[model samples]
Target chain A: MAPKYVLHYWPSIPGRGEYIRLAFEATGTAYTESNEPKTLLKHVMSCSKVGHPPHFAPPVLEIQLEAARSTKSRKTETSEDVKSSSPFFLSQTPAILAYLAPHLGLDGVKKGKNEEDPEVDQIRRAQVNQITLTILDLNSEVHDSHHPVASSAYYEEQVPEAKKRAEDLRKVRLPKFLKLFEETIASNEDEDHLYGSSLTTADLALFQLIDGIQFAFPKRAAALEKSGKYAKVFALKQAVAKLPKIKAYLESERRLPYSDGIFRHYPELDGED
Target chain B: MAPKYVLHYWPSIPGRGEYIRLAFEATGTAYTESNEPKTLLKHVMSCSKVGHPPHFAPPVLEIQLEAARSTKSRKTETSEDVKSSSPFFLSQTPAILAYLAPHLGLDGVKKGKNEEDPEVDQIRRAQVNQITLTILDLNSEVHDSHHPVASSAYYEEQVPEAKKRAEDLRKVRLPKFLKLFEETIASNEDEDHLYGSSLTTADLALFQLIDGIQFAFPKRAAALEKSGKYAKVFALKQAVAKLPKIKAYLESERRLPYSDGIFRHYPELDGED
Candidate 1:
């Protein structure tokens, strides 16, 4: 049997963990999420295995190797296989996505007979990561729009600062980032994809980012969408949404609703553009 | 001749470019900075070459291949070599560092005869990236401490919001991140490095992050340092500082001073712990 992919993250609110989920969903990869609060707390708070380092926070991806299968079929398995099959746990959303990209065929690199250029493949991977990181940076800024004063504090506590931040985000930062993404997509040879001809994880991330922004600031997002200034970005989002696996995943219950997470819908915060 | 590494960023402030510089300095790698404002603006604002995507911002790393040498030594080089040697430009600080890590021998992966395990090396690289991204996240938060309201606005405009953010940073986020780093260092087999036995780019990043925090919040950083709670983190900083290349780089004219960059010494923001 193949190795198991287990995701450890918060149970609710499609937070940073959503980026990892999109990668899995888009590729039709099988994975289990350990969202049980108590169990996840134990797994997240402690380094249960020897080789695994302590993760600062979750959306931790644990790749359980042969040991996971051997434990079920213990009588038939050899001790050597189990001994060598220690699980690998990796944290941080971008790191996790990058690790999974090539495996899921979402890295936009041609393989097999067509894989003539290793240099191009390497550059493509870097470009994918670059776009993903920039999208996440914008996501972080969106989160800060609500919790400007402190992440630890409630949004209500910093309403004034939140207004200021949301205003700047909608007015200045959002336009700047959106324009960049728009130009990036427009510049690419393939109109649908962010980097190469095929879909990459960067496109998936951008899809989720734009989706979240729309959810958080409906009026502003709608106005921008209607204006058609970022038609390429919106088109990419639509293209990603139209992917069979992604479409099914988004429609299913597995796709958690955005709530008190990074992208929250606060009426007052969603001011005029 | 080796390909030249040219960095494009703002000339005055260390900013995000500093992280890229530290990687080069720590490894004693030969690189040039295209800090001339006009030249840098052109390189940064436009995708001057084909195959290179437009960078959203700078601290762009341009690897001028055979053409850089051929331009000067046209009499010695073949047309084919120059034609194939297009410059590769990569942006995003963490992305740039990750790309440079393996080349600089700061990726914490063993090579040659001793490199028996490809899996371990891959895992080490992921761990190094995970740590580096986390430290950069903290660095971003440090930047937010003073510019809580908006990155575009002046600090004076958001002084009140800055105080709230800084207080939370000093009281909550700093301790949380510092403790995590402390525990990470303690958990590792090697006392000096974050992963494995040798230096990695993550350690260099952490050293810069801590140094910037000290610059931004002297009283708070001093108190924390004096308390010795994160002895290992500070010790790692000292260890990185004492590295001959890093030592020379720090004392040399190349090490730009902190001013209005991510970290700034706003006296009011550095409140009591």
Candidate 2:
């Protein structure tokens, strides 16, 4: 029997947890999410007691590989903290993706083909991971668009500064990042995927990035799409959305909408197209 | 022969490039740094032409591994771009660290011992990487203290808002992060390093973080250190500085001081101890 996979994150918004959710959805992996903020906070605070490293933020994936282990490991009984007997626990969205990629058979490395050269495959995966991190950087910038002055402060309080940052983001940063991703997709001779023929986590992450951007800045994203400068990125997003599992997930209730997550759509921050 | 590592970053300050330099120096790996901004800009602009992924920012490490390959890989002859025949060109500081770690033998995995179990060792490394990223998060927050409104804007322009952000950072965020690091160090049985008994990149990163904090917020950091709350984090800093290679690097001219990088010292931002 497969061990339970529990994802702990804020219940309010998709946030970073969505990336993990997308992977599980795309791969058809059965998992449960403990989304309550208080629940996540409790678990994070008590992480030390469970022998896991303390994470600064939420979106922690508590993996239960109990079946693989010959003996059961003792877990601290905490009423507040979300308890798990999982031998392995992971945090950091990109790191979580990398750890889960091999387990879900989505590492973008094939067995007997071009993946024959282990060194080449490792380098390729590193490149994919690099792309993923760059996308994450863009995501952080997007979040700052709404909360330019300070994250703790309300968007209403930071609206004045957010306008300036959003203008720069919409005019300069957005196009710059999109063009970079555009070229990345164009680099491959075959218009197959980000890392060649097979779909990798980068592709999934890129898809989510586009989705978030479109949700957060509809007018700007629409204009960029219409301009056709970043055709490859939009096309890649569409392709991922069309994936059977992904398509179903999108139509399902499991896929949450963008609200107060990293990519928030504060009307004032989203400048005119 | 080992490949020549050429680090590309802004010559003025010890930015993200410093992380890679610490790793190379700690491992005694031969490497050179290209300080010219024009060279880095050109390579970034022409990254696609050279059949490599485009990077938005600098701290690009171009490894010259031509000797290992039988054939020369043609590169676009750009007047401004830093040319390299090395197939691997990595951007993003953490990704660069991960890529270089295995080659330099500083990956923090002990062989024929506790590291005999590959699964356990990989998890441990993941944990180390997580801590490194958390330190990076702290680094970004420190950078934001000065440029809270917009990264492209000058500190003088954002003074009013920066004051508020810095106040929160110094009074709230700093203590939270330092305590997290302190607890992380306390979790380990041996007081040797951040990752259990072995020295990992996280230790080097934490050492750098503490150094940056001290440079950027002297009064605040001194106050925090004097409080004896983060004793473990300060102890780890001392442990890392005592490393023979690291000690030599610190005393040498190669070790650049903090300037306009992520961590900058602004008396106003520093606040009262």
* Each candidate's clash count: 0, 1
TM-score of chain A of 2: 0.90
Candidate 1 lDDT, A1-273, residue by residue in tens:
555799988998899999999998888899999888876666553654434466778888888665444655566546664565357788988888877887788887867622543444566677788889999999999999999988888888999999999999999998889888887887777888888788888999999999999999999999888888999999999989999999999899999999999999999989657
> DockQ of each candidate's interface versus the true one?
0.44, 0.43
Residue B220 lDDT (model 1): 94
lDDT of candidate 1 over B1-273, digit per residue (tens):
556799989999999999999999988899998898887767553653434467778888888665445555466546664565357778999888877887789887867722544544566677789889989999999999989988888999999889989999999999989887887787787888887688998899999999999999999999899988999999999999999999999999999999999989999999667
Q: Evaluate model 2 with DockQ and give the value.
A: 0.43
Interface RMSD of each candidate, angstroms, one decimal? 3.5, 3.0
Show pairs that collide, candidate 1.
none
Note the residue pairs that clash in candidate 2. Answer: A11-A35
TM-score of each candidate? 0.92, 0.90
Docking class of 1: acceptable
Supply the TM-score for candidate 2.
0.90
TM-scores, chain A, per candidate:
0.91, 0.90
